[model samples]
Target: MTTSATQRQAAASVKSRPPRIADRLPAEGENGVFTESWFPLCKSSEIAPGEMRGFGFLDGRVVVMRDRQGEVHVLSAYCPHVGADLSVGKVVGDQIQCAFHEWRFNTDGYVAATAIGDPAPKACLFKYPSADKYGVIWAFNGETPWWEIPDFDKPADALAIRVEYDVPIYPIDPWVICANTPDWQHIKIVHKIAFDHKQYRDCLVWNNYSMQGRLDGYYTDNKGGALETKAGIFGTSIFMMQGNIGGRWIGVMTPFGIPKPGHTSTYFILATEKGDGSPADQQIVDQTLAGLYHLAKVQVGEDKPILRTIKYAPGYLTASDAMLAKYLKLVREFPRSHAGGEYIR
Candidate 1:
């Protein structure tokens, strides 16, 4: 077929147009990584006292170390001089010994020791706030995290069962990828979750959320009660809360620091209330465990394939998307990361 003159002109115009990034990403732009939230960085054993570990990402890298008193500190990685890896260094008491030239840096990232006659430059490491909660190490991009990681009531007094996904490293941003929780219609279509009209009617979103519907093919019990889930989220961490929300699963899937744009490692943990430790309570535990197993081992298999290929673009949502809409509103309104310096909390 021969092209018309108008079509040829359009093609030419398209070729001349400069390429640009899509606006589907959050407005935080390149600065989005340093957000005002706590990110799951590592596990407790990963950085015990007198140990140092380093990690890298798209936004920036960080070095995790523990002092003599077992207090953990997460700081921007890389030695100011020669760009040496601070993680490979040794932890001597309250400081990290640089592998490149034996320069010792205190927990504050300041130069603590140098060779005789060597000048102690007025340089220091940039530090972010860090904490250990929910069996994970969280690092805040800012000195003061805006909110604390949500926890259940009397968790230690409960029966906690954990299930994990060898979740493949997906290329999407955590905030964008996690928006599926509120896209109830998609959950029905994508994960085989069954949400009837009333369940959809019960839709709501605040700091947390609840789903009063049947998990359908996701459990042996298949009871709507077993499927009902209460959830907590703050882009840095999102999960189906159990003990706190009267659900079969209580777990989290979160990321680390957002110094720059990058993907995060997500995980899961489930808990059941150990009331009286009676056989009836144990039965509930068994049922909850089975429900979580299907969600983690079987049902999640359905989500991974779609999650990896999802794109951030214009969305056409329906009434059932109330949760996702509110979730995005919160994500969009979060403040930027605090200025670089000492972490307070």
Candidate 2:
């Protein structure tokens, strides 16, 4: 018997539903949502010339290093030759020499030179596209060609301040912190701040509703006259806030997952630019960083325990989770082959 076209279509639809095992498995685009874009990976200072830094990103292990020429290169940390970590290897000229057998790979991750008695490796280490901008290094893992990478550049006139620190919460997916900025109720409950307080309460409420309304604009409302706003791509958001209280203070938060599954982290930086002729400008910048660090410890540190303990279920969502809903929607709609996965673990 021949199946009709309608019957074939129905069969195809059924095949597309995620399998039962997928309940615990994050959607392709859901876990490490990868789009045709650039996500900041690290500060320029973090990877110095002739230095190799191992990083866990996009659910996989990647190594970032600068050659003697001072150019940056990113590649899979695992050596394709023997599964050795490339980070332990040293940079010889433009090639990375593997520590195990001294096998060298060029900036493009192609096998450049193999030591004696070594058979030509079947495959070369995977190379990730990377670029430098705004004094930061960005890595791309999308399936599309490198030419398709998105341009991520900040304005030259914009006051830039860069701050870096390691959060103690490891293995706790970074999206939790990334999503926290848009989560309104948490600020009051977790941070234990009076949501009704004039400056604090008003700004929180505005940011919460603004994000819900999907308004793509800057928001600057704080006791210190700081402005914090974010931009969204697909369902992910990049936060940028700057305020000129005593001096110009800027903050940026970008979230990314590892190349594999089961890992995520956010890269946060705060920069304070000194204003001209402002006698108190330097002090203001210093105070701002100090104040922000304290706030981060209280707000982010407190959320760590709660977020880590909560059971994660992909489809388990609530009406109050507006940002979560938007995030999931973006995951469902975008290509996930390389994008970060869903917010849920």
Candidate 3:
């Protein structure tokens, strides 16, 4: 059948339409197969020496353990033999001893010995590259870490830090939440931060895995206090900022975790410079950090409602959205993988 001129014109118009945001952005295969980024597994103090704990990680499960020598290791949770949960197992010397079969696996995740007294088989668990830093245990997504764990510009011991791992969980991808950093409009409108837009636009730094922005302004609270801010998002999951807020020096690091697809848990690391080793000075530092943490929570409360309900389609982006636009681009090209496979379960 031959098409009419009008019919041909309609088909041509349809083909010329721009693709949707989903199509435009690079696709990450599945929710479980996440981008190659550092994921905060648990607090360092939670897993004491000679203790093992299982956590629901990325798409599956992992065990964080501390050997007798005080070395920390994060390996896939279930045992290679009989699928016993290693978290319930005991730590023997520098190895993991399975509770069910008495099989022993070392920090390298290879079976050190078998309960039956026979030579151990060639089975091994997936040992995730992990680091204990900033009072948290972090694991990288792929076999090797893309970059070092995020840290403040100042030395850690010089700062008084309070890490809150039980912050509210967001029912969304971690990247979606991290988009907050580059979202200038959201910062200005929702968080009440006022800064010179032209200066900020000129001074913003963009890199492959991170973005940093500086703002000098005042918080539009009733008092209109002076504020100078420096903020950055690293690896699509960790958001960190340090600056003077209302004449107080504060630093914050929030790294997100994925228990599974469509769910994210946030960790808050609040810090300020430590004072002189005196009772009065300690009290002042404590109060300053406490107040800083409270402000962090308040900001989270402000963003919670909108983030929870956002469909997040960038249909009509404006100039104010340039930073968010860059973040989305970084997410598109970021590496992704289900690194541990079935052993993580």
Off by over 4 Å in 1: 1-23, 27-33, 117-119, 157-165, 196-225, 243-260, 273-294, 338-345
TM accuracy, model 3: 0.90
Per-prediction TM-score to the true structure, in the order listed? 0.75, 0.66, 0.90
Give the alpha-carbon lDDT of every model: 0.60, 0.54, 0.82
Give the per-residue Cα lDDT of candidate 2 at 304: 73
lDDT of 2 by residue, 1-345 (tens): 357988988899999977543223243245435444455566778887888887766656678889887888877788876678888888877788899988988887778778885765656666666776546676765534343222223443443455454444344344434455445556546655333223332333222112222212221323233223322331232444333322333443443433343444444555545455365875676676676655545545677787767544455455656655555444334344653222111
**In model 3, what lDDT does residue 29 have?**
31
Candidate with the greatest lDDT versus the true structure = 3
The digit string of per-residue lDDT tens for model 1 on 1-345 reads 457988998999999987764436463335533446666666666777788787653366778888889888887777776677787888887988888888888888788877454888988778777886655667765656666666664555555554353556666666665566666666667655554634443544455222222222232334223344444455534554432223334543433333345565665655555557788877777776566555565555667787678776536655766666666766666566545522211
TM-score of model number 2: 0.66
The better candidate by TM-score, 1 or 3, is 3
**What tens-digit string does per-residue lDDT give for candidate 3 at 140-178?**
888998687767878988988888875567777788888
Could you tell which candidate, 2 or 3, scores higher by TM-score?
A: 3
Model 1 scores a C-alpha lDDT of 0.60
